[model samples]
Target chain A: MESFNLFASLASAIVLEAAPFLLLGSFVGALFEVLVPDSFIERMIPKTVPGQLGFGLFAGMVLPTCECGVVPVVRKLLARGVPPATAITYLFAAPVINPVVLLSTYFAFQSDLTMVFWRCVLVGIPALVLGGVLGKGTAADILNLPKPVLRQMDDIRNENHGHDHGHECGCAACGETHDESSRIRAVLVHTGIEFLSMSKFLIFGACAAALFKTFTPSSVLDLMQGNNFISVGSMMLFAVLSSVCSEADAFVAAGFSMLPKAAMLSFVAIGPMVDLKLIPMFLSTFKRRVALALIVVPVVTIFYLCVLLAYLEGGV
Target chain B: MIMDRLHTILEGLTTALLGAFMYAFSISDSYWMLLSPKFQPLTATAGFLLFVTGAAMTTRKPPRNVRRWGALCAMLAFLALACWAVLGPESAFAPDPPKKHTPMSLELPEPGEGFEPRLTLNDKEYVRISTPELFALIEGTNKEYPREIAMRGMVARSPDLDKRGMIAVFRVNVFCCLADAVAPGFLVSVDDPDKYPQGSWVRVAGEVVESAESHANGEISLPGMLMSFVSLNHEIRGHDVRIIDPPDMPFTFEVRDKEPFAY
Candidate 1:
C-alpha cells in the first residue's frame, strides 16, 4: 500500500504538470491545422538544407515549450509541408533552449550556472547533427504511413463540407473573410481533435516513468554514486527512462544529491532533449527509420560528453 | 446513421469526462499528490482548457475522427484516476518516522582551539533555517557551541523514540515538484518526548550541540569538527513547542532568493 501510494502520487504529479503544456501545444497545433496553409509554411521556411536545420535548432528555444507539447506541434508542422530536417531539429533542440527549462535547471543545481552553459552546448550539437543528417529526405520519402492512411489524412485536409470557409481554397488557410464565431469554432474543432490525438503518449509516458522510479531501489543509485563513469551512465539512463518533464527533471536529479555533479549535469542536459517518452512521440510523428536515428544519435553523443566531463570533475 | 450517432455520443462523453476530471481533480486540492503547490494555478488553467476542448468536440456531428484512436484516451484516463485513488491525501504524512536518517555533511577543516571557548553556548537569539540548512550548519560545527535556531515543520516520533530518547522533526524539501521531494530531518532530544505527539505541526527553537558518543553512520570531517554529526543533538533545547497554523503551502523551497514556505 505504501509503495502504491508513493508511485501513484509521483505519476499523478507528472500528469498534472503535463496536462496544461499538452493542451497548449495541441491547441497551437489545431490552430495551425486550419489557419496556416501548407504553402504558407513552405514559403516561410528556408528551402536550403542548412537554413532549415538552423531554423529548427533555434525554434524551440524561441518558442519556449516542453517536450510533451513539442511532439504534437512538430507532427502538425510535418503534415503541413514543413521539411523533415526543420521538424526534427526543433524536436531535439527545443528542450534545452526553453526559458522555463533553463531557469529550473539553474535552481535545481543550487544556482550553478556551469551546468546550464554546458547543457546548451552539448544539446545543440547533436540536435543540429540529427537535423542535418536525417532531414535529407522529404516527408514522402521519409514517413512510413500506408498509402491509404496518407490518402485519408490528405483527404481530410482538403475536405470542403459544402460550407464556405475561405475565398479561394474554402479554408482559413486562404485569405478568407472568416467571421469571428466560425473562426473560433474551427480553432476549437481542430484543437479538440489534436488534443484527442496527441494526449495518449503523454499519459502513458508519465505512468511508465512513475512505475520506473517507484520500483527502482534508491540503493541502486546510492551504490553507483562513487564511480564517476558508472554513476554518470546510470544517472543518464535514469533521466531518460524516468521520463520526467524537462522543467521538473532538474529537481529529480538534485534529489540524488549523493551523485556527482557530472552525473547530475548529464541527467539535466540529456533529459529535456530526448527520453523514453519522446521515443513514442518520435515514432508517432516520424518514420520508423528516422525515429531510430533520432534516439540513437542523441543518446550516443550525450554518453561520451558526460563521460569526459566526469573524468574532468572527479566526483566526491 | 445509428452506429455513427452512437459513436459520436461515446466520443463526446469520453472527451467531456476526461476534461471534467482534470478540472475536478485539480480544484479538489488532490493535485498536491501529483505536483508542486507552486504549480497550483496552472492546474486550474489546464483543467479549464481540456474541458473547453471536450465541450467543443461534443457539438460536432457523428464524431468523425473518433475511432480506435479514442481508446488511447480511455487508457490515459484510467491510469491517471488509478494513481490518484491509490495515493490518498495522507501520502505525505509520515505518522511513523524512520529509525535511521541521513544528514548533509561536507569536508571542512576541524575547529581550532579559540573556535568557540564554550562547548555549548546558551542564548535568547534564534536563527531561522530550513531543515537542510540546519543539517549543514550542524555538520560544519565552525562555531563549536550550538547556535539557537528556530525551525517549523512536521513532527514525527522516531521508531526508537523511547530507546533513542528523541523526536524527528522535518519538512518535505521540494525542488521543482513533489516527485523530487526529500525530507531533511533533525532529531531533537526532549526531556519528555510524550509532550509533543507525532504528526503535529509545531515550532522547535533550540541550539544543536555535538553529541558525546558516535551516532549512526557518523563520519569525521576534514578540519573543523572532529566527529561527524550524523544525528541532531541539542544541548539547550526549547520546551516551548508552539503549535502554529499550517499555511496554505505545505512545502519548503529553501533556495537562494526563494524563501522557504511554512511546511
Candidate 2:
C-alpha cells in the first residue's frame, strides 16, 4: 500500500507537470494546421541545409516547448511540409535552448552561465546533427502517421494546390477553411483530438518513470559514485529513467554536487533529448529507423562528450 | 455513421473528463502533496483550456474515419489517471529509516560574526529555520552560525538511530515535484524517541552543536542524489521538543535565492 501511494504520487506529479505543456503544444499544433499556410512556411524557412539547421537551432525562441509538448508540434510541422531537418532539429533543441529552460538552469546553478552555455552546446550539436542525418528523407519516409492522418494530409495538399477556400473537404480532420468562425471551431476540435491522441503516451511514460523512482533505492547509485565514467553513465541512466522536465532538471542535477561535474552535466543534457516518456512518443511519431536514431544518437554523443569533459577536468 | 458519431462523442467526453480532473486537482489543496505551488496556475490554465476545447468538440460534426480503438484506449487511460489522482495518498511521503550509518565529509563552518537568521519567536534568541535552510547552512560556505535553532518536520525513528539514542525530524524538500523530493533532516538526540512515534509531526528546538561522534551517518537517500552529498553531521540537543500538527504545507521547496526558504 505504501509503495502504491509513492508510485501514484510520483506518477501524478509527472502527469500534472507535463499535461499543461501538452495541451498548449496541441493547441499550437492545431493553429499551425488551420491558420499557417504551407506556402507561408516555405517562404519563411531558409532553403539551404545549413540555413535550415540554423533556423531549427533558434526556433525555440519563437516556439519554446518542453519535451512533452514538442512531439505533437513537430508532428504538425512535418505534416505541414516543413523541412524534416528543421522539424527534427527543433524537436531536440527546443527543450533546452528555450528561454524558460535556460533561465531555470541559470537560477538552479546560482547564476552559473557556464553550465547553461554547455547545456545549450550539448543539446544544440546533437539536434543539428540529427536534423541533417535523420531528416534526409521525405515526410512519407520519416513519418509513421496513421491512415486517417495520412488522408488528412493528402486533403490538405489537394486543397492547397486548388487554392480553394471552400469547406468541401469531406473529412472532419480537413476542416481548415477560410471562414473565421469555422476556423476557430476547427482549431478547438483539432486541439481536443490532438490532446486526447497524445495523452496515452504521456500517461504510460509517467507510469514507467514513477515506478522506477518509487521502487529503486538510492544505494544503487552509491556504488557508482567512485569512478567518473561509471558516474557519468549512471547519471545519464538516471536522467533517462527519472524522465524529469528540462526546465526543472537542472536543479535536480545541481543537487548531485557530490557527483563529478561531467556526470551532472550529462544528467541535464540527456534528459530532455531522450527518456522513458520520450521513447514511446518518438517511436509512435516517427519511422522505426528515425525513432531509433533519435534515441540512440543523442545518448551516444552526450555520453562521450561528458566523458571527454570529465577527462579534461582531471576527474576521470 | 452512428458509430463515428458515438466515437466522436466518446472522445469529447473523455477529453472533458480529463480536463475536469486536472482542474479539480489543481484547485484542491492535495495538489501540494504532488507538485510545487509554482505550478498551480499553469495546471489550472491547462485544465481550463482542455475543458473548453473538449466542450466545443462535442458540438461539432463528427470527423471522418474515427479510430474507435484509439478513442476507447484513450478514454480508459484518462479514467485510470483520474482514479489514481483521487485514490493516492493526500499527505507527504513518509520518510524511511536509515539502514546503515556512513560518515559524511562536510566542511564545518567556524562560528563567526554577521549571522542573520530568518525567524525568531517570542523575542527569544532562538532562531527558527526551515529544514532546507538548515541544510543550506550546513552544506553552504556561509560563515555565520546560529547558537540555537528550531525546526518542524515529520518524525522518523529506526534501530540505527535508536542505538545512537536519536530521532530524525525531517521535511521532504521538493525541487520540482514529489517525484524529485528529498528528505533532508536534523537528528535530535532525545531521551525518549518512542513518545514521538514514527511519521508523527513534531517541533524540535535546541542548541546547535556538531555531533561528538558522527552518529547518524548514512547516505542521503532520495531520487537521483538531490542532496546525496549531505550526511548527518550536525545534530540538535533538544531543550524543548513537542508533537505538533502537520503544517498547512508540509513539504519544503528548493531555496534558490538569498532567502533561506522558498515558501
Question: In model 2, how large is the Cα lDDT of residue A302?
Answer: 95
- For candidate 1, chain B by itself scores a TM value of 0.60
Per-residue alpha-carbon lDDT of candidate 2 for residues A1-316, written as tens digits (9 for 90 to 100) = 6677666667667667667766765666566556655455456789888898888889877556667667766776777678888989999998788777787677556577888888998899899999998668767778897545875975776655332323222222232222335778777887787667656655555666566556655565455566778989988998887766675566556655556778889999999999887899899888898899999999999999988888885432
How many clashes would you count in candidate 2? Answer: 2
Query: Model 1: which docking level applies?
Result: acceptable
The pairs that clash in candidate 2 are B101-B217, B102-B217
DockQ of each: 0.25, 0.31
List lDDT for all candidates, in order. Answer: 0.59, 0.69
Worst window of 10 by summed lDDT in candidate 2 chain A: A167-176
Q: Pick the candidate with the highest TM-score.
A: 2
Best by lDDT: 2
Chain A TM-score from candidate 2: 0.69
Work out the TM-score per prediction.
Answer: 0.69, 0.74
TM-score (0 to 1) of chain B, per candidate? 0.60, 0.75
